[model samples]
Target: MVSRMFRIETGDDKDRRDLLRRRLLETNTAASPVLRALRGTPAERQRPLHLWVMDEADELAGGLVGHTWTTWLHVTYLWVDGRHRGTGLGSRLLAEAERAATERGCDAARLETWDFQAPDFYRGHGYRETGRTEGIPGGHQDVHFHKVLAG
Candidate 1:
């Protein structure tokens, strides 16, 4: 049997902004109870945040949240629905994000994930492990990865 995928496009700036707003609200709703507790209690101010939504079949399949600083494009988060794993959709979304970074003149992309997440998946796509922090809140070390782009 063949599977079908549909892309929902938010065409204009206003539409994209609205879509992002809704996505954030949905993400906050789905986050764990602990995260919800710390949601708005940051002690310090931070840089601007940007969000991109990946919608497939009218549902949110994944999302990319990041910000560009100087020469680097830091990917704060990249998530795909659990049911949609191993479907090539993550790769497609990452490629799109890479293209966007290149267009924005970023020299590289960086992100971090726990061991239980998709470290192997990123490594398969040319990302290299750059740093690691042991014993995070849940006893899992966070691994940082980076992918430098050719101009």
Candidate 2:
């Protein structure tokens, strides 16, 4: 046996984080044939898909921010102002985002919403609950949803 010494460190280090991500990507590509095939291809890159709705006064009414990669759309954020709620702005924003994602070659969409958020709203838009994490945010739950996009 050989003796060795190592020190542990942790913080918000961007360079190290990037290095770790690159290494993990390389390892996963080497381990998976599907990932290997995606390397260096256009589909390997995530494309941003953002949609915004503005009022006549130039104020933001609603918006959806997400990205598409490898035939899937990952919705990071979707929001509508209180005044715009129930006016169908949220639904319209989501529909436009899905349409754009479909145009980008995405076949599915996924997102997470807190229980206090619009889980039913997403379900109403044809998204189905795929996962749930309870006890989040003190007595609330985080719901994950997925939807198969129509061509």
Candidate 3:
């Protein structure tokens, strides 16, 4: 017979985050050994990238937040101020980011938006719907898109 001891803690511990990261990487590597080479990918190769527009005196107007890995740019968030929307600023920001990503050897870009968000706007930028899932609290669904760079 064999016995196992278990302990449960319900709180956030900053120091334990590193332990969780190690465990996650180990489990993934066990599942697929090819992923071992990505041990420090987020810190080394996939460091976050950002683009922003500023008004006079350097006040923030709009911006993007994302990271790149293995020739793919993952757009986590893209936003423009209310005063900047519909003024082409958002399109310019995204286009510039795509150009930069192409220069960095990225082959594609990906992002997600909701039903009420700018999915159609992304389509105008050459992104195409890849997949989607419905059933949010509201009637909105999460939509994912991808665009190939011209590099």
Point to the candidate with the largest lDDT. Answer: 2
Report the candidate with higher TM-score, 1 versus 3. Answer: 3
Q: Taking the tens digit of each residue's C-alpha lDDT, what string does model 3 give over 1-151?
A: 7778889898888779767865765666667655555445533445567998898778899999997764788898899989879999989988888888887778899999997989999999999999998996688899999998899
Q: What are the per-residue Cα lDDT tens digits for candidate 2 across 1-151?
A: 7878888997899988867866776776788787667647443546788888999999998899998876789999999999989998998989899999899778999999999999999999999999999989689999999999998
Residue 76, candidate 2: Cα error in Å is 1.1
Number of backbone-clashing residue pairs for each candidate, in the order shown: 0, 0, 0
Clashing pairs in 2: none
Better of 2 and 3 by TM-score: 2
Q: Is candidate 1 or candidate 3 better by lDDT?
A: 3
**lDDT score of residue 81 within candidate 3:** 88
Higher-ranked by TM-score: 1 or 2? 2
Using all chains and alpha carbons, the TM-scores for the candidates as numbered come to 0.62, 0.81, 0.78
> If both were scored by lDDT, which would come out higher, candidate 2 or candidate 3?
2
Tell how far residue 18 is off in model 3, in angstroms: 5.7
Best by TM-score: 2
